[model samples]
Target: MSMDDQVFKRQGFGTDVDLVPPFGLLLVDFVNGFADPGVFGGGNITSAIASSQPLLDYARRCGWPVAHSRIVFADDGADHNIFSRKVPGMLTLREDSHASAIVPELAPIAGELVVRKTVPSAFFGTTLAAWLTQRSVSTLLVAGCVTSGCVRASVVDAMSLGFTPLVVADCVGDRAIAPHDASLFDMQQKYAMVMDRQAALELCDQAAPGN
Candidate 1:
C-alpha cells in the first residue's frame, strides 16, 4: 500500500459503509454548460454523462426517487455567492438559459425532482432532503459532473444529512483528470462510498425493497 493509504488506514478512515435500502438517485449538474467542453466540460465528463443515462434508466425502473440539479442563477445575478464569485462564469447559468438546462439524455421526467441552486450542494438551500425523506431514502446513489466540485459537494452534504451516499464513480467526472481522480480517492476515504455504477447497482439489488 502507498504511504498515504497506510496513514489513512491507520487513522481509521475509509471504513466500509453499509448499503441500506430505499435508495434515491441524485444527478448533480449534468447540464448543457457542463456537458459542452467549451463551456465547463472536458476530460471524461462526456463519458460520465453517457454512463449516467443507463444508470438513470435503471433507477427509474427500480422506482427510486431521482433528483437532478442544475446551477441556475437569476437573470440579474440575484443569487450569486462565494461559488459564483470564485467562478464568475457561473453567473451565466441563468434560470432560463440553455446552458443551465439539464442535458437531454438524463432529463428528469414528470414527478422526478429538479433541483436548481446557485451553489454546489443540491441539498443546500434546497428541498432535496425533505423530498428524499418523504420517500424514505436511506442510501443515495450519486452521479454527476465536475467530480471535484458539485459532485463532491453534494456527496458531502448527503452524508451530512444522514443519507448513505454511494457515489457512482463512473457516473461522475471532472474537467481535469487529476482532480477527478484525487476527489474520488478522498471521497472514498473520508466522505462516501465510492464505487463504479455496476457495483453500486449490485449492492442495491441485493438489498432492494421487497427483496
Candidate 2:
C-alpha cells in the first residue's frame, strides 16, 4: 500500500462514500467581505470561488435544490448571539452591510432559499435541514468559503442531520492555508466526502435524469 493509504488505514479513515441519489447543494457564506483580499478573505479563497462558479451552474442545470447561507445580523443589532460574543466583528455583518451580502457572482436565483444565520452551522437553529428533507435531498453537495469555520460546521451538522455531505475540495477555502488544508484533511477523514470540482460536477451530472 502507498504511504497515504497506510496512514488512512491506520487512522481508520476510508474513501469517500458513493453518492446517494437526489443531491442538493449548500453554499455557505460566499460573501463580498469573505471573497475580497482586504477583509476576512485571502489565501486560496479567491481561487475556490472561481472554481465554484461552474459548479453552481451545473447545480442549476441539474435542477438541484440550491441553498445559500450568509451571516446577517438584524439591522438594529438586536439579533446578536453567542457567535457574535466570541467574535464581535460578526456584528459588522448587519443586514445592510455589503460584507454580509452573498457575492454577486453566485447570487441566488428565484425560488432558491437564502438562509440568514448567526452561527457557524447552517443547520443550527436554521431551516436548512427541514428544507433539504422537504426536497428529498439524500446527498448534500457543499461549496463555499472559509473551509475551517462555517464550512466545517455545516458539514458536521449535515452529517448529524442525516444527510450525506460531499464537500467539494476545490470549491471551499479559508483565509489561511493551514486551516484550509487541515480542515479539508479532517473532513475527508471524518465528516464528509472531500472531492474535487470535477468529481462533484460529474456526480451532479449523473444525478440528473437522462444525463
Top TM-score prediction, candidate number: 1
Query: Which window of 10 residues has the lowest lDDT sum in candidate 2?
Result: 202-211
Give a tens-digit lDDT track for model 1, residues 6-62: 999999999997989889999999999999989998999999999999899999998
Candidate 1, residue 140: how far the Cα is off, in Å? 0.3
**lDDT (Cα, tens digit) per residue for candidate 2, span 6-29:** 888797896667787798999999
Clashing pairs in 1: none
Candidate 2, residue 137: lDDT? 97
Q: What is the C-alpha lDDT of each candidate?
A: 0.93, 0.89
Can you give the lDDT of residue 140 in candidate 2? 94
- Candidate 1 residue spans exceeding 4 A from truth: none
Q: For residue 71, what is the lDDT in candidate 1?
A: 92
Q: Quick one: RMSD of model 2?
A: 1.9
